[model samples]
Target: MANVENRGNGSYRLTVILGYDEKGTPIRERKTVKAKNMKEAKKLLTLFEAEILTGEYFKAEDKMTLNNFFPQWLEKHAKDTLSPDTLQNYISILQKRILPKYGHFKLEDIKTIHVVNFINDLKKNGQRLDGKDGKLSASSVLNCYKAFNNVLSCAYRWKLIKENPAIGAKPPNGKAKKSEVYSKEELSQLMQLLDDKPLFWKTLILLAISTGAREGEIAGLEWKHVDFEKGTIRIEQAITEIKGKGVQIKGTKTGKERTVSVPEKLLEMLKKMELTSRQDKWKVRDLWEWPDHFFIFGNEFGKPIRPDSIGQWWRRFTKKNDFKHIRFHDLRHTSATLLINEGVHAKVISERLGHADISTTMNIYGHVLEEADKTAASHFELFFKKMN
Candidate 1:
């Protein structure tokens, strides 16, 4: 079916999709005809369709709507090349933001003005589309814009577009939202609250707060990775949900692995937890075999529990207890913050957090680092006074 859309400037798009090429590739032979009204645009569309159907339309390689080319781009460019999460986000932005506005316009027809207007609209309409009443945060608007930019960048590289409209368009000016974390008092209360919770939940909270590992990294932990004598747990892989693929074990996001030391008491707790897991495994021997990797925190049948369930449970627990609700990820932030306040070195903190670079640690916890700096300055002042 053909689509006709107004492209502002006494012009309209007549999207006459030429049938697939011999290689099963769609040939979108779109045309922009000068028109003043819907009736004129419809007539132009009919004529373009006839010419396209009769094989009379001159085939220009670049004259195609982004909508027509997007499928090809995803298949040939993004499907295997992009990370599953990133590809999924691109798809989301297309459905929620990009496609409805610019799908009808040819790649060549998308100008700087179009890009500017799209960005402006995003800024103006920034609000959450969920059942909540708030608008989208600036950071969210920037993320959506980035997804939009990514598509146009690929189009430019492929020579489908003469210019990349997003190259010079104003970048999203949304302020970065501060990471939510638990205060020292709040952190203490949280641990106390979890003491009576299930072992699965309690251990998870402890590991996150103590190790500063990502939720997926913690979810991916295996029994074999813990060395009782060494008191260290190796983080080699992660179990994350890919868009099309269900929960799967994949390399870490940074593609690097590190080992974190466990406190002696916590190591003892882990040993006790292992005994409990073994007892559960005994009850379901047929479900799992020895030598098959065993997840540390698993469901009834010794299978990996849903990773999102950790966050969901955290939300529910806080709500039920009438506590200030921070996400499960916030536990990791709390760990870093507490470690920083305790005068831990940034390099050690970075290693514990599994960050590939120390700069990331410095950047995320800049405020904490700044406060640490102030304390150091105060100590220097006391030393100078004593010397005098």
Candidate 2:
């Protein structure tokens, strides 16, 4: 039941009885509306009651803000489900960007307009937090959008919100930067430079180029993962560093293991490296702290090498040699590009790279594939010309 009481000067208070509480007291919802007369007030009251019956009425008393709900969502929802790195990323985005803007807003009060405005604001004036001038990058804004959308999605799923406002909001279509890779000539030059370098640097750089494995994946490799007879390396794990948690070994990026064939030359190098490790083990038997673990790229103490150390070394190496500056991960891109140029099938390349699907391979290396396709067309054209 519902009623409207005239509260003077065209103002009316509409109240609806929304059933009983556990103590049998009637639960009521009240809204104040302004109308010209009693008849208009009655119509407003009817509409309010209809909204309640249809579940379209938003409860004003819920009072749960984003600030209040985020912790609950993190504890009951995101913590167990998301990866540690991913969870940390979400927390960072929320703390630094999303929460600061709309955290005080009641969860139910966040509408599509709020989300739209938030995204627009991010595009306009979202300054970098690193004391750098200029607005946030398109990708950074996109990340903020994703994190905000995910949180609201959870809220909607948990019935805290009637709908996810983010569903209706569109984020900026940020273009992914093209992957940089070294040319064949440049790779040859790099390989030559590696010859004068230490065995560890030589092996690590060659392994990255030959296998197209990530830095962490290479760091996570163990002697047991190598098969000398088969000339294959099992890529089962990766090292990820969590803030305040030090280094942690986790499964592959896609949570699936793969076996990759390596060059015979690389395998022979691995054999020599294995012999050196065995000798070192014998020399420092009592001093070996990680006696149980046998990382292929372990430090002098036999602990797995930090993945960051690989990048740091590459930077110094590139700077010293005055080589064409490119990121260390570009070696993986270089490997893929070299294979594509050799006319290897995309599926084989996809599998070797441990991508979840061939489409991902195509997406990342599409430009190389395009160039390969052009070269293939030219070859066919020349053959037809010779036939003529």
Candidate 3:
């Protein structure tokens, strides 16, 4: 219950009498308000009344710590919306990083100062459970911070705290910048490095570079989704890694289907691949062995290949060639960077990449596009020496 009373000195007081704390002790809190007169005091009382009615009034029971509610919060709110991959990340951070630091404490026990100190602790912890140096990367710690903030945001929405303690905390400054794109010569060397790999995996790499499809999307490719006649490939599913299983097919990242145009060379390559695949039908018969079903890139025996398998294959190929260290994802970046460098617009690149946002495409490829302009100008300046 809440009530406001005039104190007769141009001031008013609002008091909330809570039912009881967890241990059955009565809890109460009060706030003072300055008012011109009884009329203003009455207005303030109305505001307090509204707040109390909506359960926004902070009673003593509301002062319980965040740790107590974390489990309930996860069970009730986060379980369904979070993807399996994302859920794993959250649990890993909570168990390894967050719980040991702040698990025993309540929400009110946490302060902005605690958040700042925790980030510093992450930087200096210097030892992990694996007995390896635990010097946390700036980007990883930033993600932890984001995860913490998201938890607190839920707390705020649930009215667990008066304000979010994790709000406004600065993210760690990243020490590493992303690397430059591969040059044509380097790209040629890398592709040549792939000559000895499985034909299907090689085709996967080639398609990734040419179409700028994500690794998972490429792994999920099915023949039905490909239109060799129109030279187009449609993105509808993704092959993702599951804990118990090697890989599982899931919905696309945006949950929307999109089509990308392939070049004539790629269409011809697919035709040759279809012929080659038909000749070797006994390889992946145990898995994905449906009759009349066609997979653009599948195991030798006709089963769908997992994304992890493709990633592992790519790693071996790169290591064997002693090529520059870059993730398979960089292949997508290489495609976009190459296209932008050759004067392709970001909009077209975004469409090919199946990005949900044009801004994302622009943000990534904008600098590469600018660099291309500089290179073109330099070449023109040297070539036309006597231009009037």
Best by TM-score: 2
Q: Residue 82's C-alpha lDDT in candidate 1?
A: 72
Q: Estimate each model's TM-score.
A: 0.79, 0.86, 0.78
User: Tens-digit lDDT track for model 2 on 198-283?
Assistant: 89889999999999999999999999999999999999998878889777788888887889999999999999999998888888
* Model 1 steric clash pairs: 126-136, 127-135, 127-136, 128-135, 128-136
Shift of residue 322 alpha carbon in model 1, Å: 2.9
Positional deviation of residue 120's Cα in model 3 after best superposition, in angstroms: 2.2
In candidate 2, position 139 carries an lDDT of 87
The 10-residue segment with the lowest total lDDT in model 1 = 122-131
Question: How much lDDT does each candidate structure score?
Answer: 0.83, 0.89, 0.76
| Candidate 3 per-residue C-alpha lDDT over 1-388 given as tens digits, one digit per residue, 9 for 90 to 100 | 7777888778889776757989988776677789998777777877776777687776566666656777876898767766656666786787787878888887766788888887777778763556776576787777688778777788888887767888767867864567455778988886787667666666777898898788788878887898877889999988777676556677787676789988887787788888877666655555546455556777665567767676787778778778886778888888899888788877888888888889978766767877888988999898888675
* Steric overlap count per candidate: 5, 0, 6
Q: What is the lDDT of candidate 1?
A: 0.83
lDDT of 1 by residue, 24-130 (tens): 98777678889989898999899889977755555576478989988988998888777666788888888777888899988878887888887777666434667
- Relative to the true structure, candidate 3 has a C-alpha RMSD (angstroms) of 6.3
Better of 2 and 3 by TM-score: 2
Candidate 2 backbone collisions, by pair: none
